[model samples]
Target: MSLPRIAVDAMGGDEGVRVMVEGAALARRRHDRFKFLLVGDEMLIKAALENHPNLRAASEILHAPETISGEEKPSQALRRAKHTSMGMAVNAVKAGHAGAAVSGGNTGALMAISKLALRTMPGIDRPALAALLPTLGDNDVIMLDLGANTECDARNLVQFAIMGAAYSRIVTDLDSPRVRLLNIGTEENKGTESLRDAANQLKLAAQGLELTFDGFTEADKICRGDVDVVVSDGFSGNIALKAVEGTARFVGDLLKRAFTSSLRSKLGFLVSRPATELLRGHLDPNNHNGAVFLGLNGIVVKSHGSASALGVANAVHVTARLLEENLIERISGDLAKLGGHGLGNGRAAKGAAAKDAAE
Candidate 1:
């Protein structure tokens, strides 16, 4: 099925135009239906496209002289949104020139631009950063609020669960995904009032929403594969994400050291090379490269700044899948099911209160 073209921030990543163009080319090769609006310096994009005639034929270049640097702050980036490649790419989505936008630039900048351009979807108070983490089971687990809102209230958590589950359904193809809140412990009375309240609300609303409300899961169990969605405040979720990444690195480094420790160990490594290769492939970040900003009116996927062509392709694939699955509509449907369940007015009222306080 041919879908709408995806807008790529061609000058966003570490390698800039070459890698981004190559990645989009790679995606086009995998899915012939994929088309692109490559936003960057026209000369650089044209030069890069020389290597991939297929992409050149299928893509259109939008000249964007400015690029958002990795170190640029969101506020500063927002000021130049219309002029920068990152912002233009997002603007393409908002303007209906593209189905979704993908960027490997500054996450904060991309988030800010996307939120400003697309705005939050109806019934969503805040947009959360959600990503798929590799797990021990057949499917990867979805985790949200990675570093979006540092402190989320119970209402935000509930909204995150709704969004995460909608995403999980698209990615995992599960009818009713198992959803859980990340907490200090699994006990009913263990967490903060917000956690307890969100859990209570989820339990009450799960049946109507088509989600399996599994009370709580601790950090260590996030990738165990028992649950499909893990929700948390950005502070805790970001820390847990880093911890998981650190542990993966630690294991890889330890294995490398052990294998090279002695000649005998090197011989053993050769014998176990196939098994280790499989493990390495499974743990590679490239295999899971996209992080979606859920709750936005339009889709915006964040690719790792250092991601390779393969990683960028994966991010594009993710954007395509979400578009095909109608993720925003699904979330809206679920939210509609919660009518009279106390969530209908909570987000709006909360926003109003916050606005009044600011005034």
Candidate 2:
């Protein structure tokens, strides 16, 4: 296999260069074709790599000499920390030095710097960061804009759905994925004027992209697997995502304590080894390591702020798959049919409700 290059923002996470080095090493250990360009302070990176000499052979260090703090405001930090590792790493991909970039830095700063450095593809007014939300069934549900676009209009939402659907098609290979608007209720005309307007535009985007949209879906329906793509403004999507994560972790702890009590239950757990393994693997947060900021020029993965070495490693692996698949090109090509013209209002074919009432 041909080698693909990835740039790591060595100063992004709290662990700093140490975790980044370990994550890059983990990727190299798994795939010989994976080469990394570690961008960070020259001295700190060198010292960290001395402790893990194995990384030196497969990864090369790019001296950034500055770091972007997690607390710094996005747009401001990008200007102040012009020489930060995150900025340099983004430049690496923009300059063709890497195929993808991964950072656990301030998400806003990363987004701003990346957009300024690489710019958006033509016809894309705004880029969105897509996230994977854990669902009950086999595969994860795709949610976005993940705080990328806060005040999205109907047109922006339509474009976001198009990008998201392309991602699901390539990543999960779902045939005719169900796209739904995240709303207060499943009933038609249930949300704000913005949501109703967005839903109508979604129908237009769907028609242009040849995607299947199932209309408005309540938050409770996320796990039913009836919808593969859930579209919402970033503010609401992030809240629902965090709430679900907290709930899942709380339930997991409860299950662990329940199984450890008494000899009888312990024996039953031993008998149910396969079942337990299935649940643990499916529910394990580490498996879902990185969230890709889609529609950017190159793949940029934002890992969890508290991610461990294992989580970082999984992120590198995901970056590799995304690059190999050429996800951006696929998305742009598929959605080209979706012109930026105004999408007609999407009411339920008008007055069909009155006809049915008369019947």
Candidate 3:
């Protein structure tokens, strides 16, 4: 089936127009139905597109006079949201010219521009950043609130779980995904008041929401693959994400050093080359490149700044899948189910009242 065209910030990533255009071209090759609204310098994009005739035929360029810098603060980038490549790409989504927007630029700037333009969807308190992480099981785990809101309340956590589960269903094709909150321990009473409260709320609302609430999962178990969704506040989620990434790097580096230690080790490396290659492919961030902003009125995917052409294609592919699956409408349907049980409204109000009193 033909999908809506994606708006790509062609000047956002480190390599700028060349890599972005190539990535979009690669994605188009993989899925011929995909079309693009390339936002950046017209001449640069056109030049880059020369090598990829298929993409050039399927894409349209929206010239952007400025670009947001990686070093710029979110507040600073927000001020220039009119003419910047990242901003205009997001604007295309809001204007109904594109179904989604993809960027490899500043995370804070992308988030700021997306929120201001698309705003949060109905029944959502705050939008969360959700991404798929490699896991030992057959399917990757979906983790949310990765550096979006530094702190989150019980209501926020519950909403994130709902959104994450909706996303999981799309990617994993699971009717009911197992959901859990990230906590210090798996025990119900082990975390903060917010964690505990969110856990309780999820348990009550899970039946109607088409999710199986599995209480809490520790940071160490995030990629175990048993749970489908892991919810957390952005501060803790970001830290945990970094720790996992660091561990992957450490393991990869250690293997490299071991393989080069001696002639015998070199022979052993040759013997284990297939397994090592599999490991490398599994851990490569490009394999799981897209981080989506959930609960927004429109789709906006964030690609890693250092992503290669393959990574950009993966991000674009993810955006296409979400659009095809009607992610926003799925989340809205789940939220309506949660509201049907009265859990979202009642618990959120109580949580707010408790916070106000505590303050």
Candidate 4:
């Protein structure tokens, strides 16, 4: 049997080894292919493992000896801790001992480590972070550039759309899921110079989609599921993602307070328990799992820094599915098609020339 390994950055998160171990244990329960290579302090990992009464034998530990904290600069962290927990995790993915990596650590450090280790896919110049966003409506949207690249060009936006579409297909099972540019307005002239150019490019790349194209949309339309793939620059995308997250937390807390306000309200809460739980599950960041750093040579997932054990476990679960789908190669094929024919009716020929110029 082929062994499917995931390197866990044990020293990377706020929860310490305990939650990391618990997350790994949870993953082991979900998939037999999961072989966790825990990278951190040996003594700490052992203690966490001891807490698990029935720890899986598949788990292995690798000592980091050093760690990168949340506040450190990515460059500084990389220079200081080439052998840190995050660095070791990246090395494991690059060395092919693990099919994927999941880390709840410094976002910038994780991205820097991944780029240095895994590099970018051949046709992809930059690797963008994509977060799965749940909608109040039926289908959820996959939003990209959650903060990988601070500045992106029209070409980059086009790439994000293609990557998002490919991901939506293999994982979300939406063949040609609708693509929409995240804009301040829905008109063709909306957004920055890059976005305006990107919109026109999308028109030329019409057949590139697995589904038909939907136009530009505002942030509010996100919760409405107006489109399947939402493409935006990293700065704006990060702001939107955090805004939604903050709002979700605020509303959730308010609801909790309301539920226990008085005897009458408490009775009302029981009646709404099932629906309320459903809403909570949908809004929970843990259930949303980690964000994917797509367009890489291999899988490198960036779990939330504040993620709990359940969040880590969910990250592992989705990552396993990504491996089963052979996402790297899958993306290559689809993207190669875009490089040649699909988008905007063979705009790839023009796109290729532009890509060459950009280089």
Q: Which stretches of candidate 4 lie over 4 Å from their true place?
A: 1-3, 51-55, 209-211, 257-263, 342-359
- Candidate 4 residue lDDT tens string, 1-359: 67568888988778877887888788778887667888999999988898665554777888889989999998898786567988888888899888888888899999998888899998776899998889865776889989998888777887788888877776578767888888999988777777877777776665754545677889988778668889998999999999999998898889889889999999999999999988888888888887889988889887777778998888877787788788888778767766566452355535643754575
Q: Which candidate is the best by lDDT?
A: 3
lDDT of 2 by residue, 184-216 (tens): 997777976667766766665676564698898
Candidate 1 lDDT at 23 equals: 87
Best by TM-score: 3
Candidate 4 structure, TM-score to reference: 0.91
RMSD, candidate 2, Å: 5.7
**Residue 330, candidate 3: C-alpha displacement in angstroms:** 0.4
Worst 10 residues of 4 by lDDT: 344-353
Clashing pairs in 4: 176-210, 176-211, 204-344, 205-343, 205-344, 206-344
Better of 1 and 3 by lDDT: 3
Q: Which regions of candidate 3 fall more than 4 Å away from where they truly are?
A: 347-349, 352-357
- C-alpha lDDT of candidate 4 relative to the true structure: 0.81
Give the worst 10-residue stretch by lDDT in candidate 3: 348-357
Arranged by lDDT, best first = 3, 1, 4, 2
For model 1, residues 251-296, the per-residue Cα lDDT tens digits are 8999999999999999999999999999998999989999999999
For all predicted structures, in order, the TM-scores are 0.95, 0.85, 0.97, 0.91
Question: Which lDDT tens digits does candidate 3 get at residues 192-251?
Answer: 888887887888889898789999998989898899999999999999999999999998
